[model samples]
Target: MKLLEVKLLTDNLSLAEKFYGKQLGFTRCHLSADELQIEMGSSVLIFRQTKEIKKPVYHFALNIPNNRLNEAIDWISAIASPLKLNSQGEIIADFRNWNAKSIYFIDPIGNIVEFIARFNLPNQSTEPFSVKSILTISEIGLVVNVVKNTVLEFADRFALDIFVPSTSTEQFAALGNDEGLFIVSEKNRHWYPTMINAQPFPLEIKFETDNNVVYNLSI
Candidate 1:
């Protein structure tokens, strides 16, 4: 299974445009009154308008170049004050982990957005991280009410291979496919979806299969 896109609901289009288009530098692939599509390399993110949505949502991560990690962090800080940052001003840069640097921010809809640069990628020397240096989306977090069932469904339907389960202190499950990785967890978990002045709930994730079949998961 390969991830092609992920869709979420937002009531504010102007804010979406500003954050994703202006701030994040994601290209506008398609747009309409009810929906807006942003391109991240080969992946797509769709934002739809909804009036009934009111629940917390999971956060997602985008991978950039390791060298540009600081640049990405600086860019994000210039636009939005980060909710959390290390002493080095990165969202997460644990050298012991993957030696990756990352920053986290909340969109207008409360979705946790991340810009990360992994150490394993080849283009780590580039400065002021450009979108082209992004290897791929490393992870999309899913904070839900159930983990086992959600993992089973993703594995059964999307062919998501479970790479890691939440530890005793962790409440997230990470799944992977050919395209990238996704993290799933319950609402009770510590990592709650960031709300953009609205409630967050289960959302749909759209992706394409190996056969080029486009499918969506509404959880």
Candidate 2:
């Protein structure tokens, strides 16, 4: 599957624009007075301004070249401090079972953002890692009250298969494949390597599968 676009909520559109467009230097444009769109290689991320009293925070991941993990760390570290994943002050999370390495950071609105390199993928680049090296938006965390039910519902709705090496549990589950995944977890479960509790918020996602089926879903 491939994640084509995602629309998320943000309380402050101007700050998001500055952080993603100016600070990180990604290609971005103002969609409207309350909307900002950012291009991440093959995927597009849209932030819709919201006036809800409670601010919405999300967790999402971008795919990077398999060989550019270190270079990606260096590139993003220049703009924001990478969040440590271990007691050893290590920033990289090595998922040996998944054959992937990931680094995490927070956007200005406290959204947990990840850049992951899956070695099993064919995304190896000779160019230096930069914003252009981002392959696509690969994962989106969807917080729900019940992980099992949400996972089953999404599987039936999208005709998705469980990701290999990711076992479903009461707390967490992952659907789809390495190219794109929906991470379903029970509310209040801390995101991996972080203390932030998961929360439900409004968002939209558009994706396509290997068989050329497209789905536009809102949650």
Candidate 3:
């Protein structure tokens, strides 16, 4: 399934606007006092105000051209500091795993955001950077309490395939299909927790599927 959009709740709309618009470079598509919308290529990320909400610690990824790995890393580093990085300022590459060039950062709201260039994917043309080219939404991460059967049930309902179950770490589960990936993790174990960062509450996460069925989950 392809993720179309993600709606999050935030107590501070101005802060959200500045962080997403100014810091992350996401363009503001729409805005109101209580609600703000930012466009990331084809997908839209919505932020709304909420009095009582859970601030889940989640990490979502973006895909860029392999050739643009250095460019993407440099661009993101210029805007935000790295959460974890090698001496070269790029995210540490795990040769045994995906082996993608990546970098992770914490947004103003404390959400872990990632910029990645997958190595296995065929290299596309090296074109000038555009929002349509590089800033497209790739994945939405869901932080869960555990890998419970209920979580799998939810995945089935959304037609998501269990790509990889957390074996080495009981704290996480990665589920996806051709559309995109959704990572579910045990709460509190991750860097960001709901209670800590009150802004950017997960409201809805949508994934686009091959059959034109956009899988949607609302929190």
Candidate 4:
């Protein structure tokens, strides 16, 4: 599945507008008094107003060029502080189990955002890494009540593959391929290397498949 757009909540709209538009240098799409859209290379990320946000945070990821993970890290560090591991104060992580490396950082509104480089996937860059090196918004947080069922529903409908199959609900489940995924978990989990806990929030995702099938869904 290819993630095309994600619409979720942000407590501070002005902060996000500045973070994504000015600081991170994302291309702004159409904007209104109440809604905003920013282009992230092959996909778009949207932040919409909610009536109220109880937790006001989420975990999401963008795909980065596998060959330029280090350069991508340096480029983002100049703008915002990367979230570091407590023991080592390290900003980058190597998930050998997934054949991936990731750099984590909090956004202006405290969302645990990540730029993950899945080496097993095709490295689609031949130039210097920048914010433009982001290939797509490849994952979104889905704080749910049942990890297995949620993943099965989407996988069955979209014919998507699982990135990691959770052995139980106590663990997080990621469903989809290297292209995109829905990170689902029922546990009140803190984003890795950070104390910020993810909350259940309304999110809408629209994506297409390799067979040219499209799915526009809300949850």
User: What lDDT would each prediction earn against the true structure?
Assistant: 0.63, 0.90, 0.63, 0.80
Candidate 2 or 1, higher lDDT: 2
lDDT of 1 by residue, 102-182 (tens): 677777666677776656556565445555555555677666566777778877876766653223223456676424566
Better of 2 and 4 by lDDT: 2
Model 1 pairs whose backbones collide: 55-199, 55-200, 55-201, 56-200, 110-194, 110-195, 110-196, 144-186, 144-187
Q: Rank the candidates by TM-score, best first.
A: 2, 4, 3, 1
**After superposing candidate 2, which stretches have Cα over 4 Å from the reference?**
none
Q: Per-residue alpha-carbon lDDT of model 3 for 83-104, expressed as tens digits?
A: 6554464464442354456667
lDDT of 2 by residue, 85-178 (tens): 7778999999898889999999889899999999889989999987889889999999999888887787787778778887888999889889
Clash statistics: count for each candidate: 9, 0, 9, 0
Among these predictions, the greatest TM-score belongs to 2
**Number of the candidate with higher TM-score, 2 or 3:** 2
What digit string (tens of lDDT, one per residue) describes model 4 on residues 80-110?
A: 8887776768777887887888989888787
lDDT of 4 at 191: 68
Instruction: For each candidate in turn, give its C-alpha RMSD to the true structure in angstroms.
Output: 3.9, 1.1, 3.8, 2.0
Q: What is the lDDT of candidate 1?
A: 0.63
Off by over 4 Å in 1: 54-56, 85-90, 95-99, 123-127, 131-135, 164-170, 177-179, 192-200, 208-215
TM-score, per-candidate, Cα-based: 0.77, 0.97, 0.79, 0.91
